[model samples]
Target: MELKLPEIPELSRQHRLAAQEQLDRKTKPVGSLGRLEELAVQLCAIQHKVPPDTARKRILVFAADHGITEEKVSAYPREVTAQMLANFAAGGAAINVLARLMGGELFVVDVGVAAEPVVGVKNRKVRWGTRNFAHEPAMTVEETLQALNVGIELAFEAAEDEVDILCLGEMGIGNTTAAAALLCLLTEAREEQVVGRGTGLTDAQLEHKRAIVARAVARHREWVKTPFEALCAVGGLEIAALVGSMIGAAASKIPVIVDGFIVTVAALVAYHLTPKARDALIFAHRSEELGHRYALELLEANPLLDLGMRLGEGSGAALASFLVEAAGRILREMATFAEAGVSEREEQDVT
Candidate 1:
């Protein structure tokens, strides 16, 4: 199936100028917030207003299964995916607690899971997970499109509700393996360059995992030509949904705060599909994963922080959102020197 991108909603010039004026008046010197001013500007574009107000924040934790788990590359078993989903719904998971503290709604969308999850457990199971890619393709092209549609719909709903920011998260065991493989195919990177120890793999196991991914790429070289093909060849359903969500956010003009390696890989594919979408991205932070740096370079995104975090679940991204919010607050609420009737520097006369 051909990938069809949605039409973008254009913002008026008056609204952008107004947002800029508001930013300049709030506190410090012009453009003092740095990229944060850019973030607020993009938010204004999405919201079609000046002085973007962050009234609602939403985090979408996409849950999916990875077929490559059959290779025993991951330390955790596949069942651990479903188990963590339960933990998330119960508010026992780390992300759940963080989300609660952050005062945002946490939503879990089940694009695919190997084991059928209970419907009432704060999960949306799309299918019983994807097939094993070690033996064959992870998913058919049709299924990939469906996953993208799900992400697009969810994002549009959030935009309609006036959500100013959306953080894309994921829950999938052995997913880093899939993310590395996908990154390799997209960037034409060798296995050794993009592969990393996901969730603490033994050295020997890491070598095994890398070799497996290398061989998988060689096997699907033909189908790995385009971004969609590469994703179908060795992509995680959650990653694909993230790609879709990024696209939807851009099409809607909302800002997306990206997390770790897996989520970054998805954003990479989304940018590949629509280069204009680049303007809507905010790199939340850098992960401890080996390949994350390479992926960030490929996207030309500098993360806001580097906390040595490898935990997926969008933890870093959620926390970084607060910083962006504070940046806005400081720009908009803090008193400026001129406003306080302070005199300018004597050097100003020389200039």
Candidate 2:
């Protein structure tokens, strides 16, 4: 089944101009806030409002298992995918803790766990796990479409809850292997350029992982013709869901703060599917993962933080939520020069 792609909302040029004017009138010199100022403008354009309101937030942590895990590409075993989802549901995971601290409601989705259901995770399993991509396509085209549809539904539900911002996270063992393959195929990147030591794989294991990615890309070269095809051939269930969520958020006029490497891989898929969705994505951080930087450059995204965070499951996005919320507050509450009775310097002099 082909995806019924939503009509993504257009960024409002009028609101963007208004936001720039407001920032210039603020007490600080023009462009003093640098990227924060750019963020405020982008947020305003995204919400189609003069000053954006980012009070409500939701983080969706998608868990799935990858057949590539069977290859010992990761240090952690495949069972950790389900265990981490339970930890997330119990509020014991890093993402859970950070989401709570950042004031974001957390939702765990079991897209393809390869195990029995966890109590608190919403079971939306496409399959127990993907087929091994090293030997064949990871998923059928229909399964890829189904995963994307699930993500769109989740985003619409969050929008109904009045969520102003949506964050993307994932927990799928050996999924990094899937992401690396997708990146290599989509960007025509060398396997060594994008593959890395996922979950602390030993040097030899990392090399083996690279070879696996290379083999997958070579075997599925024809399937990389389109974003949907690339996804079916090498993408994980969680990664497909992230792509749909991003597209849905764009359609709903809500910003989706993307987590790290794996999440960015999904973002790349979303952007490739609908180039406009790129406007709605807020990259949370630059992950320590080697492929992340290349993905970000391809997306033209500047992440909000870089604390050496490579842990996915939305922890990075949740932490970056604080900054996104702060941007809205800064734009809404900061005093204008006229209101503050402050002398304004000439535009040329300020710089």
**Quick one: best lDDT, which candidate?**
2
Can you tell me which runs of candidate 1 are displaced by over 4 Å? 9-21, 30-35, 45-48, 119-124, 335-347
The per-prediction tally of clashing pairs is 2, 0
Specify the poorest-scoring 10-residue window by lDDT in model 1.
Answer: 118-127
In the range 1-351, model 1's lDDT, one tens digit per residue, is 667878756654676677777776664667867877876665666557655666578899898888899899899999998888888877788788878888878888778877767453434455677767777888889888888877888888888987878888999998998999888888779988888998899899999999999888888886677888888889978888888888888788677889999999998988788776666778999998989999999999999989999998989878888876765565456665568776543545645
lDDT of each: 0.81, 0.90
> What's the alpha carbon RMSD for model 1?
2.4
Model 2 TM-score relative to the real fold: 0.97
Per-residue alpha-carbon lDDT of model 2 for 70-109, expressed as tens digits? 7778999899998888888788988877877888889999
- Pairs of colliding residues, candidate 1: 113-128, 113-129
| Model 1 per-residue lDDT at 124 | 47
All predictions: root-mean-square deviation over Cα?
2.4, 1.9
